[model samples]
Target: MDYANKTGGSAQKKKSFAGNKAALIFFLLTVPTLLLYIVFFLLPLGMGAYYSMTDWDGFSLSYRFVGFKNYIDILQDNRFLHSVRFTFLYATIVVVLKLFIALVLAIFLSGKLKLRGFFRSVYFFPAVLSMITVGLIFNQIFYSVFPSIGQALGIDWLSRNILGNKSTAIYGIALTNIWHGIATPMVIFIAGLASVPKDLKEASLIDGATPLQRFFSVTIPFLIPMLTVNLVMAIKGTLTVFDYIVAMTDGGPAFATESMGFLIYKHGMAEMKFGYGTAEAIYVFVMIAIISFIQIKILNRKEAGQL
Candidate 1:
């Protein structure tokens, strides 16, 4: 009895020490990560807020602080307004198209497709490539190969110069972004589709329902959450579309394809209006926040069956 009691007590003490050691290690490990997050994300956010209230020209040490004037400029400026409008248009179109494509591809891929792994890799390949590289590749294809093909077919595809034409420039960027990003949603949708219980599907088939009915009534209802998540991601991606736009048209064709992100870059980096540009950034930040908030509320209500 004494030996057993001693062993039991010793084991308990050992476990206690081990648990304490593990907890301490975890706390230590998370501290640097927490600090890095605050430094990189929160610090810049706070600094941007400060700069938004000033007219710091980024060069002079004594630039005058102008309160709310930069925001006023953003509101009244025609180019800025145009950029914002164009960005929304681009974002909406790309998000819808990308989601549709992703859903379709995911359905097809989830089934017994041959060489599934190979095909998935192929579809996702463009996403891994650098935006600069993708931009260059698309530029050549749009400007050169497309025109050449047009000549062969006598279709005059080169006349509009898709990248240079105002009407089509944004769409061209959207197309490239879609190609580069479609894989991400495809992967997501595939996971969502997989999570769906097969028993539900089998039960639907036994009730003399058509395949289409099963998908519309049973499958789609469960997929709503996945759709919401994907929509948010696509919205975020569109709002921050920069490198691809910069590489393709440089927000050219008379500022036709200029997105808010590119506009921020132009002001801050190109024009050297650091604080004013930070003000624009804050506006963009607010826009993203508001949209995301609205989306979350709507989706949450839907999830609760209150929508």
Candidate 2:
């Protein structure tokens, strides 16, 4: 009996030692990432939060703490408010267009079509291009190619520079963004569609289900996760749009296309209203966090329901 207890205790000790070693390995593997996150992300975020309460210009050696004045001023700023509104409108347009177009393209491309490989490569080619490069190319296209074609077609609207018009500039920018953004989401949708069970689709078809009915019933359930991922990406990308605006419009045509991201850059870096810009940046961070959280929650619930 004593021998058995001793043996059992020895086995337990060995098991405990193995578990400790695994935990140590995990800690060692994760520590570097944790340290980097703290240093790069958390540290900067904490400093930005602290600076938002102050009146520090970018080059200042010293500054005074104003305590939420920047936040209050931003809240009342009409230009900032307009930028926020414009960003929302742009996001809505871009997100809808991207998801719809990507879904259609994905569905078509996933089928057995001749030259499918070539078409997929062509569709995905835009995603590999630099956003700035794409923006510049589109800028020239809008300025030169579009107007020439428009004039040839006798279309007055197309003949004019769309980016130069206050009302139409947002659409031009949205078009550029959509052109670049659709590739990634389309690939994602294709992957999701690929994962859909062949048997289920065949069964649905055998049941005399129409293409639209099969899509709504079987295909859509499988694509829900992809939809959620694309939605989140689209929202975040569009909400913080800056590069395209800089390349295409520079928030031009009477600041009609000014986005929150560009506004923050202009104020914080260019204008040297460091404290104010930091406040605006913090506000944007909070807004994004809340929206993302709510979106994830809603989508997760829907995903669970589908399951």
The top-ranked prediction according to TM-score is 2
**Which of the numbered candidates is closest to the native, going by highest lDDT?**
2
Native-to-model Cα distance after best TM-score fit, residue 217 in candidate 2, in Å: 1.8
Residue 2 displacement (Å), model 2: 28
Candidate 2 regions with alpha-carbon error over 4 angstroms: 1-26
Candidate 1 runs further than 4 Å off? 1-30, 158-160, 300-307
What does candidate 2's lDDT look like per residue over 1-307, in tens digits?
3333445556786665666665688679999999999999999999999999999998989999999999999999998999999999999999999999999999999999999999999999999998899999999999999999999999999999999999999999999999999999999999999999999999999999999999999999899999999999999999999999999999888989999999998888889899999999999999999999999998989888978
Consecutive 10-residue window with the lowest summed lDDT within model 1: 1-10
How well does model 2 score by local distance difference test?
0.93
Clashing residue pairs found in predicted model 1: none
Error in Å for residue 139 of model 2: 0.7
Overall lDDT per candidate, in order of appearance: 0.87, 0.93
